[model samples]
Target: MSFSPAAAHPRYDALLAEWCDLLRRCQEPGADGAPAPDPEPYGRDLLGRWGESQRKYHTLDHLQAVLDRATELTAYAADPDTVALAAWFHDAVYRPDRSENEERSAHLAERALPEAGVGAGRTAEVARLVRLTVTHDPAGDDHDGEVLCDADLAVLAGDPAAYAAYAAAVRAEYGFVPDDAFRTGRAAVLRQLLDLPALFRTPYGKEQWERTARRNLTTELELLTA
Candidate 1:
């Protein structure tokens, strides 16, 4: 809830605090006035998944960044808290080698949220937003989708050094692929992103992030092709 939550992650107390805040916003108060259900267990479970040994780019640090970005863009969302829920579950089932991570992550949210006190509509919304990450292309009027998509992709607009680190981390994640194959695949992905009319849909993202992200993606693409 605070501005300093930028560093709030699984290893720190702030992440747990942040999750509880999100839970409170989406879940109705317990029968009468009792406190909302505890959200820490689910948060902890997801944190453990993020901290898995195979991860390099899709780690707890990435989750923290997405959550932080979603917080920054909260004003653009029709339901900011619901977007945050999506952030937590977006990579909950990440496995660099897997093709269905998004679907699996969405399923995890669908099964877990209702039991965690989130209403059906919000639960489905969270799952839908998680699935959206597969493309990161939200419709023009989809404010909540825009927020979550932009937040997940904000890393692309980072400073050169940060972008370099992100690129390196990604290569590390797909280490199993042969060098030539990885380069070709990576270049294609970059080209697809470059082909988009705009890499970011949110106004702030379009204005503040678009140019830099395009530059970064182009640079990466060239490197891969070269």
Candidate 2:
């Protein structure tokens, strides 16, 4: 299940529709009276909220990147819904101060997924995937978590120009700071990324993105320092 960036949006919209239909099918008649809101509008609302957040370097594009990679990786794997749901909600609450972004995002998804027709067990799996993105650490790993983390970091392993664009977009999202602060902070992030044992933890990630990601990081680090 390889995805072209052009076609991914429609594919995702169709998936959202199916998820909404599942909710409607499982609903008790008149439970909420009128009728369920249209899934397109509801999905748009979620995406819009994500877009408008001031602290969004990890915006819809970022989510899409993860989903695209997850789709490719999961082609040879299983439980695609867990990866899909995680991609949608992993960055739902995007505050910079808290280190618990993943936990909060997972909580938001846990509440939202049940309302959107996901089962309790699957919701837990989605939450697990969300947590996986918090740190690229792969020890004591689950297969799904590894896939999700690799997908999240795939941006770093993209083509150099695209990777640089992503790096700039990330800095722009946090552009309230002074130039010096942004430079220092951005440099630190690249250094930390360089310090990683491997940017893509899973074999699929390694195969597809490991080299490109390292190239992007090293190039950016040199540019940032000089």
User: Which candidate gets the maximum lDDT versus the true structure?
Assistant: 1
Residue pair clashes in candidate 2: 157-213
Model 2 Cα displacement at 42 (Å)?
Answer: 4.7
List RMSD in Å for every model shown.
Answer: 4.5, 6.1
RMSD of 2: 6.1
TM-score quality measure for candidate 1: 0.92
Pairs clashing within candidate 1: none
lDDT (CA) for every model shown? 0.88, 0.70
TM-score of 2: 0.78
Q: Where in model 2 is the C-alpha error above 4 Å?
A: 1-42, 53-56, 96-99
Q: For candidate 2, write residues 1-226 as lDDT tens digits.
A: 3333323444556545654554454333335565544455446555654565575567666766777788888864457667766777788777665569889988887887667555678888888888877677756357777777777888887676787788878777777777788788888888887888877767777887888888888888788788
Per-residue error at 160 for model 2, in Å?
Answer: 2.2
